[model samples]
Target chain A: MLHEPASQSGPDASADYKMRIGVWMFLLYAAIYAAFVAINLLKPLWMEKTVFLGLNLAVVFGFGLIVFALIEALIYNHMCGTHEADNKGGE
Target chain B: MAIAIFLTFVAAVLGLSFYFAAKTKSASGYFAAGGQIHWGVNGIAFAGDYLSAASFLGICGMIATAGYDGFLYSIGYLAGWIVALFVVAEPMKRLGKYTFTDALDAKFNSRGIKLFAAISTLVVSVFYLIPQMVGAGVLVEPLLGIPHYAGVIMVGAIVITIVATAGMTSTTYVQFIKGAMLVVFSLIVTVAVLVRGLSTEPDQGGRVPFYKYATLEAKEVKGALVVNDYKVLTSVPAKAETYVKLEKGGVQTWWLRSDKDGKIALKETQYEVKKADGSKLVNGLPASKDNVLRQNGGLEAIKGKTGPEAATGKVGPFEFLSILSDPETRINTWKIVKLSDGEDKVVVYAPSVKPGNKMMRPGLKFKTEGTPIQKLDFLSLMLALFLGTAALPHILIRYYTVPSPACARKSTIVAIAAIGFFYVLTMYMGLGAVINAALNPVTDNMSAPLLARTFGTFLFAVISAIAFATVLGTVSGLIIAASGAVAHDLMDRYLQLGHTEKQKVRAGKIAAFVVGIIAILLGILFQGMNVSFLVGLAFAVAASANLPSIIMILFWKKTTAKGIAASIVTGMVSAIGLIMFSPSMYDKFGLNPATAPVPLDNPGIISIPLSFLVLVAVSLLTQKKEASAA
Candidate 1:
């Protein structure tokens, strides 16, 4: 029933994942920050409503999910990938 | 590969338990890291312990469903931390042991102190524990597509195993992982929102429109409604539809669409007529009923609908706003419904813009746009949030995990950093769910997960697992508290079992299992209630019930054991009683909410002060304290 995998390197699993995740997250943060400031200043001469998965422009933006997703998909996945052997097998 | 990934995550955690369990050979190691964990690690564990199902699922769901008002909870939760920092954190570490009882009995060793403190911890922790287990049950359904009961059992078994095997050692690490992941990932989600930018639209990919027709119930009678929260006019087919009878001058017909790419097209038809003047009137209370106040629509627009289940009556317009802004009205919400179809339900919310305000969300509350009630609601909520943090039991216990009082202080700072950043993200997460318009109607608890789902199944899986882990981490901490009460406070301190350390550890493990079972039962009992709101109640109880005793004991040297006993019993009993007769509780049990006796959304404003008063008075009367008990 206990599902958390033991890291071969111990707490370093999360720490390592955290650092890598932090880097991508910060990158995503910077990109979003740049975009927010740019648009407010430049106000984009002719803005078109961009659709994502069918959602409107205003609804699509935020920092948490973007930074978080990169962390999970890129950072944790990479760090934990090599440790798949430790995961419950044939569940 | 999909199953593999899921299994891998689960197996990894279990393996860690085995590893930690191996290292956790002593009682101290199992219960508070033998007071030896790193400050940084303990800090994250604090986050893990604090950010339970209620914080992630309940608050996020409320925000997604309610709008700006929903975020008030997050504010209350974070604010509660300040109390922890200045009041409980340092001194608690200084006076501490395995449980809060030890601290109280430190100066005056009396049975009265032992008995009452044990009861208070058990009552509060049990009250708090139910939701975590129930949330766990609720969580597994979407993840494994399993039934709720099965999920509850699964979580119970797993938690028992983790606690039984490694006790506090593994629990601490689990919490740390969860707390860190939640903070970081939430930050990531916020960044995504900013980069993705705001949208005045809905996700069309898999969004469904079902509010085309909804049934409202009052006193067991049900009626069909043609609900349309239309911003622009669009005609709904009359072929099989019963038209809404519009008065001559109401806010005549408006269109309701889930923004630009709405899957379900909705419209509203209002015609508020004037007597050559402007006013509203309904059956009598004012034919001017604003869309008649959707019980579910107060925050944003979706989940606030009122019915037997949460999403039934569109809960009329201005319902929650009335609760939030008004002092007399306690929201009596209904339990969740199965909906004949059995596909489960979702709520779709849309945010509105009102100028010159600290926050935004439209059609939510009249007070929002410069109303006196709105200001009061904001103040009440803000006051509670700021003072409520440190009073929480789960949050309090994290302090003892660190090696020294110095580390405990440093850990709080780290927690503030992590927790603060996450709270900032909750705003975007809530708003993201709203504009995305791809939200679950029945269980507002599903907001964040549903939001992740809008992005893709992979994100959904990851978020769900993380959220599940969140439930595990928080529930584990809460259960630990309960078990400590049983083993450390009741068994040893009160009952004087005098069992060796191994036996004490075993008793705690057994107690954990019992508490876990109780939590599952409570989760099922309070099915429809939002986890976070309930958690807020828990915090209110903790603050009211435990905080006074702790504070008074720490400062007042003349404190008598009887005084502490009286304060704890009074706080627990009063809070539970107030909650029982609360409009929210009455409504959930399918009773007329009008019968409720309490007058406030939170009892802390009154209860906290009452507890303090009781403690002081009793202390004064029972002075020269210890001898009387003998």
Candidate 2:
């Protein structure tokens, strides 16, 4: 027989909403990351093209990904925190 | 001075550990910091825990040596944190009490889940710990002037004391301090690099300048010559390749012919040979202070510059990269070749000049024009890094330190911000090393610290100390995670040991000690081995073995305990097995790489999917039995 969970906590009212938003965002990021690998594989020389601010595509895209992730993480935290606060008040 | 700074860092870390030890009496406190860590502190600590020596030294060294290929690791590593935040962070906080195994077995609570998860945790932690320990040894040599084994033992002893004394509480604070210092210092280094800017002939500060090359007509070249009391044996092979082997009083070096309009132009190469008799030679001389390999690597020329003194001072971040990306700019990069000469192993370090535009792009190490297998290896490595961060036991357990899911999410954002900013700095630090004549051509791992030295010895000392702290913080986390797997999951939960809280804590301390010693031994044993590959292997294993089970358990209702257990074992075994038989390992074993059975060095593309398949198939097969039993 399976043992019970070690501690009992109340159900998270915001779990489903968070899950929906989180999965969608994860998929979006995954697609973008996949494109990075694909481009490096298919047309590696294209990374040399100066696409932004005189930096090559490689430097621009690589920096963009890191900055983009930070922004996405902050946005996710804000949305999740707000949703949690709303759910707690309603409950 | 570096030793003094390093000792001070160690003392502060120990003081913090002992301070926390007094308050950490219970299992909860020892294991999870009593779940009271502020989200902001926990967030920076997360960055500390995640950015191991591999991320700092290895990636920077890679960028310094290989250019754009090195940045790929930074991109993949940071991207993995997204998976952690968006998918794993909140759910993990809600489920786990002490360890990640607690979360995996939360719903089922099966002994099987506990056993496999604990084993997987231990394996991954140990695999990760070895590299950090080895890196500690490597850093200590330059910083503290100690032998490699002493450095490994020093780190092992300190980390063990920290984990044994206060466990996760001490580990978190160490990581937090380390994370903040690393980011701030890296930013400073980046600023210094920008201020120094691009120069064709960088001021080497009285150090050895770049080595010069010589050219001769093919017909003018004699079979042998004696220059400066050194015997030079020239060989002109049928394949139009010309090379010269130089020997001076039993010392050996090699120079390879370079392309110069069909002329026989020979580029100098520094070589170290270890004869079977155990004697060593450096650059055709005995291995000593005066016979050391000359430091090389700097801008051959900057775009639109007519003379060596031309400089681009105080360039902006974009302008720095832009100047480097210019077609006319050229920089020096080294290519390594290993050969055996009559039972003596010779490693030749040769420098090649490439256009800055080419170096700023992705083809140097990843081999965009290489074989299909090479491309697959690159893809697999990126995939593993992307999936591995969320699955690492050390990274996952940080969730339990936070009080709420919201804090966990908040802290994750903090970590991403701090870590992302540091990665950006790494690019500058790496490029700075390339153009500053700061590379230790033999050990690229010294790039960042050496770059610091180019500024001043004091900065070098401080950077090296923080780097050592970086290793200490990471090792403490890994050891604590491993101890948790042993004390909490394996001994207490899986075996039903029924130990009291104090006994469990004692058991954890003992486990930490044992793991620390084991890590130290392994670190010493593998002293001169390349550490980057070990880190890559750990990531591949973590992604392959742990991620599929994690994703399935959280998302799929049909994920039975049997499926989870099977998936974890399958993933772990398959990934490790593939790596062991991969081309790289074969080369390590002194066998021909082409003869290796596994085509791909990284097993993520195969083992990850294979693990998912095993979980699905096993879950389907066991679903009926599980339902009937319930």
Candidate 3:
């Protein structure tokens, strides 16, 4: 009962689909973050320059990352929920 | 009043623990809280468990001391949870029964998997526990007038009782309550900071003059340190010769010293006041009680002194940052310097006056522009903080508390929302501590609580108690993870002891007590170290040892049991081995830190990739054994 083998045709297919979406999100997020870090390492002085209204580049970019994470989470959650809903209807 | 409030909070948590003890009759109830926590509640509990003293005390202290750089930790920590949500959450919930090891061993019933995974959990948990225990010790001295060790032992006893009796059920509620209270109180403080705005002079005291020259007139009399003369620019403040300003090159500054680094350094000048009873009072205060070098406290000048907006009496949130960013602002802050000349070593408590523009930039600490090693150290620290969140054993186990995979995912999003908001509030709190002019000279961890004291004793008491609760909640979660690894994974699963559910629960309780004792001892031993640095080391170890294996098993189709086990051992050993001989460790041991074999303080840059390579190579070699579906 503990080790129920994941069925291939029913819920497994949905799980597989969700996994692919998860991978895609992870990659996109990682790429964007890597760019932010690269800027920090290579040209840290650039980050000190003011970009927004009175705020510097580092503050703007840092807050931007938080806002970016929130958006990604909401999007992924909605997509996965929709996927689950569609699969349930198919059943 | 503070002591009464502290005792009340402690009693409420203990009462909650005993009440939940009745509900835990089986291993499931003790280990995973019966898998019945509401997703909303469990989500916030995740925030409660994750914040620790590091976020509340350490990050704020760093910000109070280092400015914008401290908030970087907040950003890095919160960003790492995205990996937890996107990659680890659903699969972890779907596979694991009680502990993180349960998920790793799901694909293969390999003893090697359980053994190594359990060991990794213990190593990471213990490393994480030291900081929380140390923070507990720090709180005890100021709040209850007890020695550091007594506070550590008190927390150890309380946490062990909570874990032994109710287990995860009690721990979860403690975390939930602590998390909610921390966020609410932090919000209240942030609003207060904005309302009070920025000021050059403290409301309580008159301004002190800034000097430019300081000469520590001391000569070696035989083998003892003797004072010949101590003179500099002086206004003759009430208590004699304890402080002096510098006036170098016609620029009146805050400090003066003989070191090559001519930058302003404040020294807590101590004068010997020998009493008839053989007791000593250095500078009007007893040398024995909490007098770790003293710094002057009154504020000197405001940012805009004579303009239309002079003093800025009270400003809004954005206006606060602008005021701190102004070049005209001067702030008094501590700069610790360890001066060792041959057999005689003197620790100088150097204070400095710095401008707002310099404080709002990076490179005060973690010099990104120094040497190649320093820059690499900064990047490596960021990498570990970003990747370590998903790999932490205690965090991974939280997934099992939820019923379904969807609940697990939703809970993670909820956690992100709450944690993100709290982190944004840390910037204001940390800067507010500086602007409030109540920083604890010796330790930055006391920044938030000391800032609260400026408001009133009630706010101060509440903030301090909540900080202690933060320590308790985190330590309990860590102990639960450690206990699960011992009883469920090591004993029942790996050793094939075949214990009944009741016996397994009993074994877990015993393991919790043992682990709590070990944590208390280590915490006391590693006193005076910053909580954030200790936490950074924990994150590095977790990232190196556990992250690569977890990532590979979930994504790579060719991953075998042997590969996973080898990676865990390699990652754990290499990271810890390097850290054991790291420069920081050498410094901690009172040896020449430059003589350390490993140059880098953080091992994630080296060990993380090495772990991945070992996993891939081992997986290829063991390909003929079995192919687990990804």
Candidate 4:
């Protein structure tokens, strides 16, 4: 009962925030896929790994992601509104 | 030999389904453990559900045949969990409703967001399901001697029935059961490994090394290796193969079949003599392009060898055996040397899927030529595993099953412990399969079950059944996620199909059925690729498309719903589009990989960051636009 339908929520409910967000995300996405295809073609130095597990010192290194995923979660709760949507359920 | 026991497993799973059928009257009960699972129980269940046919069967099979490189995969997979616990676990709980899309639409209420998220979920889910279904198909063929397709159908039907009958509730509990059993039984097998220990020598009457790659007279085609050429390679070990001995040409040869059929058999084939120092050959040029090289990945292959060279690859006391199964480097592999009648020598390259690689895909792909398939494979897997875990709709829903965020967090902690422990045991089982020489050759997915068979039929039955349950639990979870997209995201969110709670639940059930069908078809389409690798792709898409939007919305005030919507749509679309055009799918769809649209097989290395950057840039530019309108 708390969250109403889009048409029902008030003038603010129809906010184009959704579309705006979608477009931004899509651009970044397009860019990333492009880069991936490019890397395969280029065969950059970092992508070269003589090691056993196929890990590389690539431009798109996995070590950074491992660090980032952990950091993003702990330091920030995805920056969710502790003020507005504070009604989160507890375990 | 294990057909009766396999039948028993199928029966047991079906029996369990009948028991839970009545309780699954509602969609909620079927999909999310009735939102009543305890954090601890669900935690273990999560671990169970996550380990699939790939982990149990593939890794052990790879290690048994391939060597040290096979074990490296296990380490990479286990390492990925650390990323999940610290970064993804808590935030994912906060995102979405029954699907990853729900959380995305919270801020924007955008149809674009809903559509894209649903599409992405379907794409990743279908890709992931293929391996599971294919593995099932592969398993039935050997254990039951049934056709591959029959096995696929059996598993697909059983999984569909399970999801249709018990929904999330049964799935969760079943996962817990499978996870616990997989770990415990594997421990028993590992003990068997230590007890029996490595044989002092190969062909010691009954026992042998994990694998025996042989060719009575192997022939080398362009991409194919044949039997005739194997004879020449083995016949003249006195030739250049044995001549240029800088350190005894590092080659492993076994005597199995001289011909395609067992009609022509040889008792032995000479392998390149392996001294202690020679076991360290990590990389080298193809010895001869025409030499026919064969590998025996499973124990069955060893028992069924048809030639003398079949045992040539077998190394002494501990030099080859010890180095072969190490997880760090893939040294001491059975190199294929294909010999032709007169053309050129050809070598068939066979990679050893390490336990970690089989456990989870490595996150390494940069779209480059210098990059070996292994590096590309490693990156692709890591990308998917890291990103996919949090974005899973079923996993997210598990948080809501608990009483509070604290419970969600606690459940994740428990899950980490259990999953971590289980992954550890998988390594032991993988190594055990090597020494026991009871590994499955072609499909690494059958490693764990075959390893169990080496001990006794009863153990094999239990292990195989647990693996089946593992499939049941995961497939059920995926179907629930897909259904949620249909019912909640597409129907309710997009169409504005207002309905009562009862109606909503019913809609979900129907959606589950449809998704189940879709999963079955996809499972059949992409059969050859490993399941863990497929799952890794799923992870990459989920992480790229869904995770970024959710994280940005929760944390950034500048994030208007518009930014959130855009990011989710982009991430989902781009990742899916890329995967569809990828070489992996192209071959499946009967298209040439060279002609395929997407250049790189994996999209994560680029797609993930693109998501984050878009959110930040758009949020900055459009901050005032939303404020004035409000």
Pick by lDDT: which candidate is best? Answer: 2
lDDT of 1 by residue, B250-345 (tens): 443322233234233333322222232344322112453243322121222223323323322222112322222222212212122111112312
Which ranges in model 2 have alpha carbons more than 4 Å from their true place? Answer: A1-10, B205-231, B234-242, B246-253, B304-306, B341-344
> Whose DockQ is higher: candidate 2's or candidate 4's?
2
- Root-mean-square deviation per candidate: 15.2, 2.5, 5.9, 11.6
**DockQ scores for all predicted structures:** 0.02, 0.58, 0.39, 0.06
| Model 3 Cα shift for residue A29 (angstroms) | 2.4
- Give the Cα error of residue B494 in candidate 3, in Å: 0.5
Clashing pairs in 2: none
Model 2: per-residue Cα lDDT over B140-180, one tens digit each: 88677788999999999999999999999999999999999
lDDT, candidate 4, B212-293, per-residue tens: 4322443446834445433234332421242111111554343433344634443343233223433311212232433212
Q: Comparing candidate 3 with candidate 4, which one achieves the higher TM-score?
A: 3
Q: Tell me the native contact fraction for each prediction.
A: 0.00, 0.62, 0.29, 0.04
Model 2 native-contact share: 0.62
Better of 1 and 4 by DockQ: 4
Q: Using lDDT, rank the candidates from best to worst.
A: 2, 3, 1, 4
lDDT at position A85, candidate 2: 85
Over B391-446, each residue of candidate 3 has an lDDT whose tens digit, in order, gives: 99999888877777888899899888889889988988888888667676668888
The CA lDDT of each predicted structure is: 0.59, 0.86, 0.80, 0.55
Which residue runs of candidate 4 sit more than 4 Å off their true CA positions? A1-91, B1-12, B24-30, B62-80, B91-97, B200-381, B580-599
